[model samples]
Target: MTRTDGRLQVALVALCAAVFLDSMDLSLMGVALPAIGRDLSLPESTLQWLMSGYAVAYGGFLLLGGRIADLFGRRRVFLLSLAGATGYTAGLIASGLLTEISWRLVFFLPVPIALLVLAAAPLVLPRGVRPPGAREGFDAVGAVAVTGGVLLLVFALTEKSWPAGVVAVLLLGAFVVIERRRSAPLVPLEVFRSGTVGAANLAALAWACATIGWQFVAVLYLQQVLDYTPLTTGLGIVPMGLAIVITANLAGRLISRYGLGRVAAAGMLIQGAGILLFLRAGATGDYLTVLLPALVVHGIGNGLSFPSLNIAAVAGLPDERQGLASGLVTSAVQIGAGIGVAVLASMMTLGGSTLAGYRIAFLMAGGFSLIGALAAAFGLRPRRPAPVPAPTV
Candidate 1:
């Protein structure tokens, strides 16, 4: 209708497009892992790092990224990030097409995306009201501490190195202390005081943990156990992706009616039910009977829960703290993903048999989803309608 509205719409489109590309990249990698491992001669232990490493870095820096967006301008950061991501995606495409390549390429795939978002500082984005004095509050020490801590923690989990884990704990402790002391902390400790924000983040973390873990196992099961080719595996999962997309569009309207907590809780429960369906699947299971149903259900749950969680996270935050809220929620997602993959993968390998391990992992995932559903139910509050102003005489 208006120029501002048009610009906002364009900006939203761009953001949505960027997110879609990022999601596509993740899904593609999941399907391609078996092929990459075979081609690069990577072991299962090392293969797990491909996802975990990205999760760690992405999660660890999310707060910092949000802080940067607050200080430097969200538009600038977003554009820069998109550009960097585009470049990395191109590199990944090239690597994927090559006959001979190293597993290291897979690890490096998300790096460019990260850098692109960072470098997008110069690009023009929709103009909006800026938070006053946002630049003055940056916490350098806290950033380093948190980032290093998360990275080391994830590395330790993946590599089974206790020493690194200890170091990670210490660094994270230092981060807490640093944040407590800072006048303008990267993440205001006060935000966690809100039940809604805290619960939403926790639910987000749990959701990611379950879904990502399930995805890791599912991909392997399809390729290794079912003996499907990479292309076939990817194609097979397309329905799930489509389901997620379709349901996500519908979720917003549902939330508008049912509220975030109800929608999110219901979504989580549905998702958990879908994962539970996998318990019946075995080595001899077929795609239609064993995987498709679970996939569709899981997709529906994802579509509903993700948007609801996001809305709940920032529902009542001041504009000034919006960036921090976003960062915190995203960090939860990344951390959950990293932890889930590490824990579930370990369970799979440690189990007596591959099929047994897969079952265990799926069960654990379902358990986490149910737990998240409970959290969403108890923690989140419904949005209140805005008051209407009286008409002037």
Candidate 2:
């Protein structure tokens, strides 16, 4: 591979790892919440904030992070964010909330603070100290919408049903309006304008939403319904991670040959299939026969689609527009995640039991994935690269 290609590959891998660990860390803490509550003297009222804080912090600043990278330097911003998060973690540990600070330290500090660094790193590296691009500017608006929606969602989270949902819808509509009107909009109008690109991104949003939703449901299924310990739950889900690694390599080679439409359609199909399988899993089903295989398929689908979707979404954009392209993709991902969680939260409230909630979530995931599959199959028709301008004779 060429040097630049090598860097992107290496960087993408690292970025994936960082994002993975960040996600796992937040999940891990949820797994450990019972222990934390027992030891820290945390008030029942404030306990959920650990997860909420991270969500808020990560979602809140992602666009700002992208903008900073666009205007300043990505490498520099990443380095600083890394340093800042490290320091934040240290301070968080030292604060000793169990003795004094309590939920305030545990919930509001380390998790989000660390993520602020993690979120900033990707944006900074891609854009750097240069023009962020018209599309990027557009995506920044999308970023704000994403952040506002998250905040409103979180603020309204742990509350009654209708009120939270209403707030979420309103904020989402406001965000969409802002995105449409902004000159250098947060997400490029063109992204949505291009049928292939638009379809890919919207499909990505659905897939991501379903991905996060299912993962959330799966963990709850293992822990709350089946009464598995946190470690056991983590072990059960480990196969999916392994599957993603193996499948992504295979998908990379397949994409240039098959086209993004076929690959993405396959991804959505696999994702929907996985969720369908999970929905059928009873409180007493065997993990190996049901959950394991489903996860493996789901992981492969995600791995195949993730990188290729990025490639397709940004195809044919000018170099100046690269940052905007990246931002749009990033914003879509974050917004999808937050929306998924909110939707699942609503389902859980309606169902009451962990299993019932999980069933509802899996169903939603399956439906969304199917929609994504349909979009991929029908919406994308690949275009040949535009002819280059001729050199002067």
lDDT of each: 0.81, 0.67
Error of 2 at 303 (Å): 2.1
Q: Each prediction's TM-score against the native? A: 0.87, 0.75
Give the runs in model 2 whose Cα sits over 4 Å from its true position.
Answer: 1-53, 96-129, 132-146, 153-185, 351-354, 384-393
Instruction: Name the candidate that leads on lDDT.
Output: 1
Per-residue lDDT of candidate 2, residues 170-254 (tens digit): 8778777876787655544555677867777787777766887566657656765677876787788788878878888888778
TM-score of 1: 0.87
Residue 50 lDDT in model 2?
Answer: 53
Q: lDDT score, residue 231, model 1? A: 74
Position 153, candidate 2: lDDT: 67
Evaluated with TM-score, which candidate comes out highest? 1
* Range of the 10 consecutive residues with the lowest summed lDDT in candidate 1: 115-124
Clashes of 1: 7
lDDT of 1 by residue, 11-128 (tens): 5555655665556555667777887789779987777778877776778788988887888788767766666656766676577557455544554565554554344333325556
